[model samples]
Target: MQPPTTITRVLVIGAGAMGSQIALTAALAGHTTIVQDIAQGRLDAAAAQLRESTDKMVKSGKLAEEQARRAHDRLEFSTDLEAVAAAADFVIEAATERLEIKKAIFARLGELAPPHAILATNSSTIGSSAVAGASGRPGQVCNLHFFNPVLVMECVEVVRHAGTSQATVDTTVELARSLGKTPVLINHEVPGFVANRLMGAVQKEALALLAGGVASMEDIDATARMALRHPMGPFELMDLVGLDVVDYIAQATYAATGNPADAPDESVAALVRAGKLGRKSGTGWYSYSR
Candidate 1:
């Protein structure tokens, strides 16, 4: 199937940090964006976050005041998924990282959204290949992996599954470009895509180093920042991304490939089990003043 010449109406499922930021970007790109989550509380929080993000961008001079205002104005938050999906020209699912959850969402989106609408997943590790069949429109289903703090991250991976059509990929690439992002096309689906896969190697080593008591977290982090010139160390980035998120990505990759190297570090599992999720939870690898 051919993609619509333009995707002007977008529905984003889930209104968490990543989802809200993605909706904001789409709105800023002049699309009428709807953000839907199951809970009214999440939708309300997402709305508040959207305002804060747009206001921050304007104040920081990253975005013009008028454009920021318009972007916020274009965003609509809702708890009614079916109603929002019906009107969308494109649907992006940024829900939980569970395969079953995503498949269920895709099934519902397939049944509710317009047949011509493009279905995309913003999964960091679990590729669309696993969920596209649930959409029953696999050719239109692809992965549009946007990094955290979506506004600041310029790279977006446009991943094509075996069934994803070239038209869908082209349209997704154009959509990413329209949002002022650099889109890298992944001709075939892979666990963790590209960026995360590379990061995974670093994270694995970081975990191994810590597990072996080679250095303290601070020392390792300083080495990465001061010597390697990385903006943040693996542990710091994990704290920001949330240890749970990092753990989930690692586990997903391990589950798909059955590679022991993809398994999350024991320390990460211990943290998650103890409810030290990360920045949002006030602690993970590091503590936060909440």
Candidate 2:
């Protein structure tokens, strides 16, 4: 079977914030999109959130009423992975940042998805190569990492593993462009790809400063905004990205490299252990009224 040259039907496996946003992006781009999740409750929540987001966009004049309606009409939610995968021309797994869960999902997609379907991961830290073998389609497997708040972020990292075909990379790049995103192609695989790696380095320093009492968190954030011209401080960004996700990425990197320095900071870990998972959980580095 040949790789897909054009993707018309997109299956997003997982209905979390990222998956829902991705499906919405595809639908808005005129592709038929399906969001699959194990639980109906999560799917229901995702649908409600998508509606709220589109309504907000319409109110902000970012999207027209007809366009939002059409996008919503083109999007679907399902719990049957096999059914959706079998019909999808492109499948993007946006599940949690866990290797075991991703591998299992890929393994199922390998058996269920059409041979021409391109399989991709939305993982920020775990490279697609780690789960590509399980998919039985390494050449078609690559990373299409979209930043959080997908509607706002413009950059989509299209990362290829050693076995990923140039054709697959090209197709994903085209798909990203279709979604109104800028695609940055990475010829090789690395933890965190490009943006997140740079952000991680900055976050490490920020955490160190906070730990050493060099400055208050608020003050450090102010410095980044005022001096570095960054719109948000490291701590603020961490809250938006979810502290649990930050900890998981750090843990994944540390496990891959076996470097203590790559481990999650004690402060971050403590917050995560306390169930303060940033914006989604209503608290992290700071509290938000959710």
Each model's TM-score, in the order given? Answer: 0.95, 0.96
lDDT of candidate 2 over 1-290, digit per residue (tens): 66777888999999998999999998999999999999999999999999999999999999999999999999999998878889999999999877899999999999999998999999998899999999998898999999888988999999999999888988999999999999999998876788988999999999999989999999999999999999999999999888988888888788878888888788999999999989989999999996
Question: lDDT (CA) for every model shown?
Answer: 0.90, 0.92
lDDT of 1 at 206: 85
For candidate 2, give the lDDT: 0.92
- In angstroms, the error of model 1 at 90 is 1.1
Residue 236 Cα positional deviation in candidate 2, in Å, after optimal superposition: 1.1
Runs with alpha carbons beyond 4 Å of true place in candidate 2: none
